[model samples]
Target: MHIETQLAQHRVTGLRAQADAHRLSTEAKPPVELRTRVGWTLVELGLRLASAPGPAPAVA
Candidate 1:
């Protein structure tokens, strides 16, 4: 019984490690600075769109 319990605990620990590995693999995304810079620049440019364009989209 003790050995079975230990095996079960080991299996649970191994599963948790596997889950952590997968979570990190999926969630360790690259920084958004590069994308944000272009978006921010566009937003800055669009701020004066009323006088610059025929029809400009709303910016977030």
Candidate 2:
């Protein structure tokens, strides 16, 4: 749980850095930053799936 919170904070920090860098430049975002963004999005998606409700019981 502590590690999870740290990871979430790191994701927030990374995204803010990317946004600030982009705002300062005309060129498109770097590939690494793009990949990082995708990775974080996937991580959040997986976490949501992990915490979701289980399936209903089957009929007899």
What are the lDDT scores of the predictions, listed in order?
A: 0.88, 0.90
For model 2, residues 1-60, the per-residue Cα lDDT tens digits are: 699999999999999999989787746645568888899999999999999999999999
TM-score of 2: 0.41
Q: Which candidate number maximizes lDDT?
A: 2
Pairs of residues at least 3 apart in sequence or in different chains that clash in candidate 2 = none
What is the lDDT for 16 in model 2? 99
TM-score of every candidate relative to the true structure: 0.46, 0.41
Clashing pairs in 1: none
Clashes of 2: 0
